[model samples]
Target: MARTVRDANPDSRTARARLEPRGKPYFRNLEPGLHLGYRKAAKGAGKWVARHCTGEQAYEVETLATADDFSDPDGLAILSFRQAQERARERMVQRAHAAAGKTSPLTVRDALETYLDFLDANRKSGLDARHRAGAFIYPPLGEIEKLTTAKLDKWLTGLAKAPPRIRSKAGAEQRYRVIADDHELFRQQ
Candidate 1:
């Protein structure tokens, strides 16, 4: 004999309606600058619907719970997650432009000064000593404010004659070529 399966509730059907309370929820408890309403599915699942204002076009979001949930501590914490993502995206775009050598229309001297400031903030512990030695090896071509490619070439020539003194392990004078061939490549650019 075959057995027949019976419906758990033949009359059951999904219900749909606006889930927000009759009046507007308090402004302080809602996402600032935007109003959203919480909706509940027939199965009691929750979602969020954002609108420019009450009785305006609403955008449905599957993740957020009801307006009551917004009043809870955990809901407030979750709301900040979207805000934080927006801030991070803005910062990343700024950093990408800086890294691409796309500086503002600032003068070269001004750009160099800004770069120096960045170096100072992130300098290594021994950077000052290294810079002092490097300065002796490659003296400034002119007042950094009046620098030109020709003046820079003249300064490099001076280094070729008497490179900065490099001390040996025994503290003896050791002469080493400080000007690399590639030095001219940078000057040309």
Candidate 2:
């Protein structure tokens, strides 16, 4: 397995404590224009952020998650140093995809269908994939060019956190229900 080299300062909590709190984040350049940032506050643990240079002087910035300095990492809202860096890179890639989507006229639904067609021709599990995608991915995703990371995250989190469905046989028909779960009403989501 390949091992990743850790950064010196931001990768360590002890090293971070030596730095002062400020509005601007301490940045480590991942590439020519992409940077991962740690923004420390005076009262609590810092947040992980990412910066992407768009043009000559323009840049895009986004806060990723809370640093796992005072608490254990959760891999979601709270992130370890390495996790933060990985999330930063993922966000940058998503941004690039969104930018590319601006010129493409295809919607997400169209892409999914096209992929399904390809899978059906090339793979044996295409029917299963089509059913699963239709049940899960195809509904909420509409005629949009690109889905934001936040939307995708929320949709996946909702699926993970949703309560188990309760199935009951009534007369000759079988029905699935979520007991006291808010997602019961929006099962297609």
Candidate 3:
């Protein structure tokens, strides 16, 4: 006599077939994107189904429904999904770090603000007038964070060679002296 398999639940119209490799069966009305597989442990254990995505790389991700059923096939699929997710997360973090590394060390706007603040602080302290003027012309010579010493020296060199603004003879002499004094101080340090 031939064996006939009837529906497990007579009240339900769904027809299930046992998937091979493991005998778990899937319902005939299974939703799209579902890949049915079987569990290894129990004969009556439910089917394992995973969702599929299309891209340059294809991988199976077991549906959340199968998480509680830790049979061999489901376990493998879940592990693969977790590994993919972790790799993607790591790549994103690395990309963020690389992007940050490419930005300039000191922004011009920030450097300008720091230089102005240095001038104001020195003026209030009754520092030498020549030093104050030199600090004004070479804004970066004073204490300005993030501007490297080499960059400040370059700015000062440009100022020394550039023509001075015409003013009273005494004022011009004072400006030249300030520049000369600053040059000496920078060399000594």
Per-residue lDDT of 11-109 in model 3, one digit per residue for the tens? 111211232334443322222433333233344434333334334557344432232233333433332333323433443445445555624344555
Q: Which 10 residues in a row give candidate 1 its minimum summed lDDT?
A: 7-16
lDDT of 1 by residue, 68-186 (tens): 32333244333333432333344344544576675553344455555566777787634664455345532453125456788668767876777556555544555664655696874
- Candidate 2 lDDT for residue 83: 95
Model 2 stretches with alpha carbons more than 4 Å out:
1-8, 102-189
Q: Could you tell me the TM-score of candidate 1?
A: 0.24
Compute the lDDT of residue 148 as modeled in candidate 1: 71
Candidate 1: list runs displaced more than 4 Å: 1-114, 123-130, 137-139, 142-144, 167-189
Task: Give lDDT for model 2.
Answer: 0.82
Which candidate has the highest TM-score of all? Answer: 2
Give the clash count for model 1: 0
lDDT string for model 2 (118-166, tens) is 9999999889988778666877775667789988998899878766545
Q: Model 2, residue 5: what's the lDDT?
A: 83
How much is 172 displaced in model 2, in angstroms? 46
lDDT of 1 at 1: 88
Candidate ranking (TM-score, best to worst) = 2, 1, 3
Q: TM-score of model 2 relative to the true fold? A: 0.50
